[model samples]
Target: MYTPPAFREDDTAVLHALMRAARLCNFVTATAEGLMATPLPLFLDEGEGEFGTLYGHLARANRQWQAPVLGEAMAIFMGPDAYVTPSWYAAKREHGKVVPTWNYVVVQASGPVEFFDDPARLREVVTRLTDLHERPRVEAWAVSDAPEAFVAAQLRGIVGLRMPVTRLMGKRKMSQNRSAEDRAGVAAGLRQGERASDHVVAELVAEEGAS
Candidate 1:
């Protein structure tokens, strides 16, 4: 998260929006043995804490949950990114001093991590997570859609997590360090990229309009 002033994303609302849009996150923790990470689908409870709380789950057998990491958990959320070529910089033509770079958005959240295995809490967490991802679908599914015994058995194999986020670091590098003309060139180049992520970067550049 080495964000220069021109590329910093300090707005809480913007950070939360990026987190919500990022369906998957990398959850990392420190253990006596070593560092461990898991890619997980997480949901945010913005009203529950000063910054917010993260909710996710992992298999019961996953050693990551067994380790004591009450206050040393971090979740990384990555948004759209694009490669910036020197050709996209106006300075390249004037002085040929421009080099390639990357423009992207990311958020890192760290806080105390708590693990819960209680059946009731696990059930609630699972349902909430499912609803969050399924709400947009025509035939959304629910936890209760399965039989009681089946779902209960499934829950037994996993554990729920709650991380009360204490710090939030966000970075949005959208050609802010470039000259206005260079930034515009980068934006225009990204707008026509075949990758969907590049288009996203283009939109972010347009929104910021920073140089």
Candidate 2:
């Protein structure tokens, strides 16, 4: 969250797009006991508030939900990330002054957290979540695909969460601080990596360098 001006992303639309693209986020809250966190797949209601509202669910057994939050809760969304070796930096060849680094994109949303257990509300949240993920699959699944009694019983084991985002912080560190030549080398190096995320990061690096 400590972002330099070169990496800061303050555009609301860009921040929301990055948030939407992230399939999962770390939901964290400060409690009297300690910091509690959960990895959750949350949906964003972009029109809900000034910064949009986040919706998700937590397991009924997850103690994080039961803990009293001392302050605003936070959701950390991670986007494309990759390791950048100094070997990829032109500066390394020009003068051995380069060091290894990492390039990544992240968005952190924080606000008051609301937990609910009403069956109807939980049902709606579950359905919306299911539809959002399933929409990309060929054979999409639905909550109605299961038995009514079974679905009802499953919903009982979880709780719904709502967070009207009050603050949004976004950072896009795609080798933006590097020289154009160094950044190009980074993009080339990432494109050669085996991980799919590496390829994604490559495109971002190339775009940043071009800009």
Candidate 3:
């Protein structure tokens, strides 16, 4: 991530918040063959280590888990993002020097990757993941809702992952580099757009500008 000082985010709390809010993450690892990546939903255990420990699972047949990692594995989490048009910049009218850019929030966690096939560990991971995502629903489901035999069989088809985070990098580019007037224009323009994510970015831009 080539982040300028204005866009760089180094606060651990903010970075962890972004990771928790992200719906999914891209898990990447460098291998002797090449680079392999998988889209996964991972949980962070904040109290487990200095940074945190990441937990997730991958399909047993996914070759990504079999590859030998070169050094460290990376998990990329993305937050709200939106396109910013030149028309939203006050500088465009001043001297026609404005260009289009994007506003987004992202975080990357890197650490040694470990894969396991222990049934007990897999069961715990599955239960925790299920509970985390289902908590907000009216009729929340749980691993115990399914028959033990069936759940055991299902767990056999997957492998568990654990990565104790050794490094964390975060970036939040919400028109922070723009002048106040230009940022206000961007917030206004995005708030009028149709996408829900655009509206989120708009609010973030407005909040940052106000600060």
Candidate 4:
């Protein structure tokens, strides 16, 4: 994350919020064989340690869990992102010096990785994860909704993951480096776009402008 001072996000609260907003994350680890990455849904427990702790699970047969990791594992959480066209920059018309860039928010957490197979702990992790994602639904489901035997069998097919986060890096590139007029143009352009994600980024850009 090569972040300039204007784009760096160091607020712990903001970083945690971004992590929670990211529904999925890319978990990466350096291994003797090579680097391995997995797309996973991770839950962060902010009260666990100085930074926080991450919890997730991987399929029992997934070789990533078996690989020997070096130092710390990284989880990349990407938030709303959009392509910014040069046409959206006022500087493009003024000096024709502006180039296209991207507007996005992301957070990366690094920590020692631990894999466990304890059934009790696995059950608790699964329940917490399920509750986190399901709480907003009208008919929220729970691990207790399923039969004990079935849930137990399902748990057996996966291994638990825990990473006590040691470092957190956050970046929010929302046209903060651009002039006010250029940023306003970007927000207007993105808000009028068809993609829902672009609209989201537009809101973020607008918020940055307000700040």
Candidate 5:
């Protein structure tokens, strides 16, 4: 992540919040054959290590788990992002020097990854992951809701992963580099967009601009 001082996000809590908002992440690793990536859901255990630990699972058929990682594995969590038009910059009117750019938030966590197929650990990981995503629903589902024999068979098809995070990098590019007036223009423009993510980025732009 190429982040300038104005756009860097270092607060641990903020980084975690962003990660949670991104329910799915791209997990990448380097292998002797090549680089491989899988889009999966991972939960953070903030108390596990200096930074935190990541827990998730991948299909047993996924070859990524079979290869030895050359270095560290990285999980990329992307938050709200939007394209910003040069027309939204105040400077565009004054000097016509502004160009289009993107505004977004992202976090990358990297660490050594351990893949395991133990039934007990895999069961726990699956239950926890299910609870995290289902807690908000009126009729939340649980691993126990299914037949024990079926659940056990299902677990056999996947492998659990544990990564004690050694590094965390976060970036929030929310028009922080623009002048206050320019940023305000961007917020106002995005606020009118149809997508829900656009409104979220608008709020972030307004808040960072005010700061």
Candidate 6:
């Protein structure tokens, strides 16, 4: 991530919070064949490793996990993002020098990629993942909800992933490079928009105390 000093997020807690809030992530790995990527809903065990461990699963037949990884894997977690038009900037009117840009938060985690197939480990991973996403629903689902034989059979069709984070890079670009007046204009413009994501970027701008 090419993050300028103004947009860099070095706080570990904040970075972890952003990662946790991201429900889905893209797992990428370099292979002899080429770059392989998969979108998955991953959960983080913040207590697991030095920098926390990521857990997820993919279908057993998915060749991504089977590929020989030449280096550490990468997990990209994206938070709220929005398009920022120059029309929203005060500078655009003041100097007519403004251009379009994007404002967002993202975290990239890199670590050795490990795949597991043991039923017990896969079962634990699946159970934890299920609980994370289903906890918000009124009627939460559980791994044991299915028949023993059926659940066991289903588990055989997927592989478990564990990537202990060795490096974490976080970027938060919310008009930090803009002047105070321009930032305020952007925030006001986002607040008026109907997209919920724009509102999120506004909140982030506020949290950063940028303006």
lDDT, model 4: 0.95
List runs of model 3 lying over 4 Å from the truth.
none
Residue 66, candidate 5: C-alpha displacement in angstroms? 0.6
lDDT of 3 by residue, 14-42 (tens): 99999999969999999998999999999
| lDDT per residue as tens, model 2, 1-211 | 6999999999999999999899899999999999999999999999999999999899999999999999899999999899999999889999999899999999999999999999999999999999999999999999999999999999999999999999999999998888999999999999999999999999999998777
lDDT of 4 at 207: 88
CA lDDT of every candidate? 0.91, 0.95, 0.96, 0.95, 0.95, 0.91
lDDT of 1 by residue, 21-82 (tens): 99899999998878889999999999989888999899999999998874479999999999
State candidate 1's TM-score. 0.96
Point out the higher-scoring one by TM-score: 1 or 5.
5
Write down the TM-score of every candidate.
Answer: 0.96, 0.98, 0.99, 0.98, 0.98, 0.97
**What would the TM-score be for candidate 6 when compared with the true structure?**
0.97
State the lDDT at 58 in candidate 4: 98
Tell me which of candidates 3 and 5 scores higher on lDDT: 3
Model 4 lDDT per residue over 1-211, tens place: 7989999999998999999999799999999999999999999999999889999999999999999999899999999999999998889889998788988899999999999999999998999999999999999999999999999999999999999999999999999989899999999999999989999999989988898
lDDT score of residue 82 within candidate 5: 91
Candidate 6 stretches greater than 4 Å from native: none
| CA RMSD of all predictions | 1.4, 0.8, 0.6, 0.8, 0.7, 1.2
In model 6, the Cα lDDT at residue 56 comes to: 93
Query: Per the 3 Å backbone cut-off, how many clashing residue pairs does candidate 6 have?
Result: 0
Candidate 1, clashing residue pairs? none
For all candidates, what are the clash counts? 0, 0, 0, 0, 0, 0
